[model samples]
Target chain A: MTRPTRPQSAPAEAATSATPVLELRGIRKSFGSNVVLDGIDLAVQAGEVVVLVGPSGCGKSTLLRCAIGLEQIDGGEVLLDGSVVSGAQRDQQARTRMGMVFQSYDLFPNMTVLDNVTLAPTLVRNADKAQAEERARALLARVGLAEKADAWPNTLSGGQQQRVAICRALAMDPEVLLLDEVTAALDPEMVHEVLQVVLELADEGLTMLIVTHEMSFARAIADRVVMLDGGVVVEEGGPDFFEHPQTERARAFLRTFEFHRVGR
Target chain B: MGAEFLFQGATIQRLLAGLGVTLRISLISVALSVPLGVVMGVLFTRKNRVLRAVLRVYLDFIRVMPQLVLLFLVFFGSASSLGLNFSGEVASIIVFTAWGAAELGDLVRAALEAIPQSQYDGAFALGLTSKQTFARVILPQALRSLLPPSVNLVTRIIKTTSLCMLIGVVEVVRVGQQIIDFNRFDYPMGALWTYATLALLYFVICWPLSLLSRWLEKRSSR
Candidate 1:
């Protein structure tokens, strides 16, 4: 390895619990006969940082949507703490327990950065406005946007907006966070600024399932890496999986990524 | 002679009284219509198929009929057919409210529908119920989109009150007509001067609204 991986920063949840925070069972999804995700199964333990890496159109983004109950799965069950969360009825509760950040950082344009963070608690959780605002301020400080609490989302840079998106999800105190290509939409210079915020969350022991194309960042942060191809979990293991792929498809995919890593 | 009648105390008082009646009709109709229009706008944007079709039919029905015909239908035609009892002023309120609401509702629907799906997804991802999301995220964005159009609608409704004159509510236009009739022989050019004063009064009332619409367009567009 040219660079050493960071030591495990995920919290003590793994030390105490045997159950995975998120689990996908034989998940199958397709759009009108074009199968996006064939039968696939995966599990993410509490406080485990699993990075999903694949060539484009491998169903990484769809998997995150399915996990959060945003998109319905065709066949498999998305389980949170071993309970089925496949129905639309369960989405509200599922969303509360888990948060997902999009590639575009879909922050509410009409609200300020602080209101964006506190809105759910005030409306859904009935959290006191003063308490929510105070907590939001602290979260803003954590993401290095303390001074931007009152500013609208449109005023922030792409990096700043992405970080605020992360903070917005974190404010809910969700057990696990799903990041769907959070840095893919950012400017090359701004990518690290957003990735840095994700890195801190991982270190704080927040369980996260990340879909990313940044091979280097994936290698550095993932406790386990999942490779997806043709809507299936082609292979999954530690960071070493990149250096050594057990499947022909994975080897081919990783080889192209490595060769084109310069172009990216 | 025209200038003498233009500033005459009785003539000026008659014009101001007409203006007062005009303002009252406009204000009352708006109070009734704006709320109904906002509700229509919100309902139209929602996914309820039944309500959408119903609102669509209602809006189409109102939009297709001329306001004068509606005023006559409610005030005269419906008197025996529908058995509704109201004075001309009240009838004006009813007809204008329906017309104003339809126009406003369409504006609202357009505004709400224009919001991006990403906004809805983001709001839902935050664990907000769809209602909560609408109230917090979707509605605010729609409000911004609807502002310029709303100002324009207000100006249109104010002008439309002139139609109430046909029903003898003695509003701005009809009162001006009465002034022209009273002085036609003695003042000779009284008709031209009286009508010009009416046009000026309408201008005064509607100009600020046009200015507001332009300002809102610039603010929201930016």
Candidate 2:
């Protein structure tokens, strides 16, 4: 399913040949009269973790959903690994290349944790039952929930359920993973464990797009950070976006989040 | 006292024969109605405005018209008007099927609509097409909701079978009437017992259905 993905400009291509596995250009979405995303442009290289941080209702989740083809975008294009991933069509095939973990831990409550993880693999990928189960077991083990495989999703704690959600996404072997507030619903102490699993996945070369409230975790793990306010990108930078913010908006936004004092 | 004797004499034979007809009509009508109703429900829920308007009119007509009136329309009025010579039993089946199908269709639509919109989106995100999602995910969940109402409908069908006697079908109530007619002098109280026993039999059948509805409700809630 690989395509010839040659970037246009020599310098831009050289910088990008980490070559972005996912790109969104001039993406715009609106609900009737209210526009949520206006001319947004972003890209993620292979194995990079890009965290989208924003205040509530700033349309961070909407952007992630648009990229994953869960919600249709009213304008512009989404490319997954140099292939068009959005439009009136392209839903199922595009979704197969990416996986999403919803904030509510949308694990199928009627299914066991193993079945939840294995569903996309067996159903979407057409893997046999044995292969799906095996993959589910290995991924569950990675998430530290191997023993929780046969348990119902409702029986697991929020943290464990979120981990299972991650395992479910991994089973798809997606080229890019979209995580929309995977730990927002978790108990504060439990958030670290789930974030650690995501950090580990990023380390292991998974291309990830995450929307999160945990600023410190984002600073530590993300290769890039994109700040959104009023449904538009306010800033995009590396770790220094947190250290030496570029704009007053970025500084004010960063200060609202209580980061632990490193030293005076 | 003599009524008790008549019941001991040949009441058992007649009641059994009547029971056979009751079971036969109820089972057949339910068999035809449940599936037909589910399909109708689905059709009515479609996005097409013209089709939706037609279904609304049909359902409203069915809901307002009494079953006895519909039965007469189908068995007497429509059959005769159309020059058909259908047997009383066949006519009874036709009337009940139409009645049950309409009611069942409404229940099916309610059940299907009750499924959360998220479930459909969930399946779509998994790459399942609309048909696959409906069959594998939506239908199973909808069927669970459809169960209690379906059982309730079946019980209703059983009770409604009594109305077939009015159209000259030899079902339980008609057989009871026959028993009373044959032994009026020998047993003054025989009619009371025969009618009472028929009520008792219907109660026996329907009480379990009521229990089943409760059970299914509990299961779905979990």
Please, what is the whole-model Cα lDDT of each candidate in the order they appear? 0.86, 0.82
Q: Candidate 1, residue A31: CA error in Å?
A: 2.9
* DockQ measured for candidate 2: 0.36
lDDT for each residue of candidate 1 in A77-163, tens digit (9 for 90 to 100) = 888888888875675767798898998988988889999999988888899999999999999999899999999899899999999
Best by TM-score: 1
Candidate 1, B88-184: lDDT as tens digits = 9999999989988899999989988898887887877789998898888988888887888888888888898899988889998898888888877
Off by over 4 Å in 2: A1-15, A258-264, B1-10
The candidates' interface RMSDs, in order, read 1.0, 2.0
Second chain of candidate 1: TM-score?
A: 0.95
- Tell me the tens digit of each residue's lDDT in model 2 across A141-257: 998999999998888899999999888878878898888998888999889889989887877778889999888788877778899887689999875688988988888888887
lDDT of 2 at B106: 91
For model 2, what is the alpha-carbon lDDT of residue A6? 24
* Share of native interface contacts present in candidate 1: 0.76
